[model samples]
Target: MRATLMYSAGDVRVENVPDPVIKHPTDALVRITASCVCGSDLWPYASMKPEDGPARMGHEFIGIVEDTGSEVTTVKRGDLVVAPFAISDNTCEFCREGLHTSCAHAQANFWDGEAEEGGQAEAVRVPLADGTLVKLPVAPDSALIPSLLTLSDVFGTGYHAAVAGGVNERTRVTVIGDGAVGLLGVLSAKRLGAEQIILMGRHQARTDLGREFGATEVVSARGDEGIAQVRELTGGHGTHVVLECVGNMPAYQQATGIVRPGGVISRVGVPQYEEAPIGFGSLFRHNIRLAGGPAPVRAYIEELMPDILNGTIEPGKVFDTTTNLDGVPAGYQDMADRKSLKVLVKN
Candidate 1:
């Protein structure tokens, strides 16, 4: 088997690695059919040190179950399924409450390479098999594979941002980014019935998609200028919700600047900064609440899959490039260089 490994910043390799096998009664082995690079993966790809060299890459994927452990009952060998980015037992108290990312099970985890496997490979060992794998009605050759694969992470993540920010029919939203998650945030906000959607992004191509996804306005400016544009568009009132999908200090500051009092700033992008304003002038004085974390996408698969199936939305449009396992290294470079929105890897 061959898998992707980040040997250091800007250095990715697809090298031969050991194949996976079921190691626990709650585990299953999945042969990856489709997977892709995530925006968050770029964080490490930008600055990972030599000491942190060679970590397994990829968390989102759709695959066929090659085998399952004795305790796995929800799926069987040869079942086509989607694995959420996080591994969890859906029966846990947290999962029941729609927070599968916080699953208390010993084996539950995000795909951070602690398990010695990844979705960007020939196959992977899935822990919490019964609880983590969701059966897909589509076949291997379905045209909906790209859309279905988004359920594993990006679309669900965008939905989490909208849901957590309490977006509703009357709320106005400002999504701070035009990446896949941010563009999908526009879609999610539109689906949730937001009154207006303002997408902040510099890229013309991505912002164009944001409009199709439901952005009523696009602001390509940054810093105070960007804030002024959003305010002007909203009659100086800013917006009721700010979906901060760019996980940077500047993006956070923009969110704080553009959110109306009593609004929420939802952050789904993995933060690159450790320190941010949380004082009265930043959030407390305005009564603004900050929300969003790793999306518990496991809970959203069923809720989100139907729209993709019915063609109500096409979140898969985020994937502008496709490649095979061999093209993964170049695919990462394309995304890092802003030449691709997202890259889909097919086996």
Candidate 2:
């Protein structure tokens, strides 16, 4: 079998590797049908840091179950499943409280474990299969493949952030990025009944998609100017909810600068590191709520899956390009260089 390997930061290659087998009683070996690159993957792919040799590169996928352990009862060998990026047992205390991402048995393989079984490869050995993989009610059509694949990450994640931020019918929300996750944040806000969706971005294609997703206003602001523009649009009061999609210092400040005193700032961006400083005093003075983290995608997948299946939400629109598993390195490059919004790999 051929799989993607990351020798080090800024180095990714396609190499022939041994296939994965079920190693745990709760594990399932999945034959990946489709997988996609994530913005988070670009962090290690373009940086200078130590990474696992031959580490798998992707996490969002929709695949057919090739085999499952005797304990796996939610799905069978032939079922098509959307596997979330994080593995969880779904029965843990945190999982029961809708925090599956923090489940006691949750596991994420992008940085460790079997490097050959990440979502970017031809196949993956899914841990906690019964809880980590969501079985679709029917076999998805080819055209719906991208949307189904998104259920594994971006779509559900974005929805979780928006909901956590309390974007309601009367809320005027400001979204702080233009990535696929950011675009989906706009959609999630709209679906949650936000009346005025303000999307901050400069890319025409991404901005256009933001509008389609439900952005009532588009702000092409980059730095201080962008923050001022957001204030002006809200009568100097700022928005009611701010969605921080970029996991960088600049975007973090932008999110804090443009929300009302009592507003909620929900951040879903996967931070590369946790060394940055946040103004706790300012947050307390303004009575703002700062809430966000890796999305508990499983908690929302069941509810969001039906919408994706019915064509009510087009999360697949985020997948701007596709490539074979062998071109995984190029996919990372394109996404990092802003050459593509998202790319899918056919496994």
The Cα local distance difference test for each model comes to 0.94, 0.85
Q: Which candidate's lDDT is highest?
A: 1
lDDT of 1 at 16: 96
Candidate 1 — which residues are off by over 4 angstroms? Answer: 113-115
Worst 10 residues of 2 by lDDT: 106-115
> All candidates: CA RMSD in angstroms?
0.7, 1.8
RMSD (CA, Å), candidate 2 to true, equals 1.8
Per-residue C-alpha lDDT of model 1 across residues 1-347, encoded as one tens digit per residue: 99999899999999999989788988999999999999988998999998977899999999999999999999999999999999999998999999999999888899984549889999999999999999999998899999999999999999999999999999999999999999999999999999799999999999999999999999999999999999999989899999999899999999999999999999999898899999999999989999999999999999999999999988999999999999999999999999999999999
For model 1 the TM-score comes to 0.99
lDDT of 2 at 188: 95
Per-prediction TM-score to the true structure, in the order listed: 0.99, 0.95
Cα lDDT tens digits, model 2, 33-60, are 8988898887777664563454667788
- State, as a TM-score between 0 and 1, how close model 2 is to the true structure: 0.95
**Candidate 1, which ten residues in sequence have the lowest lDDT sum?**
106-115
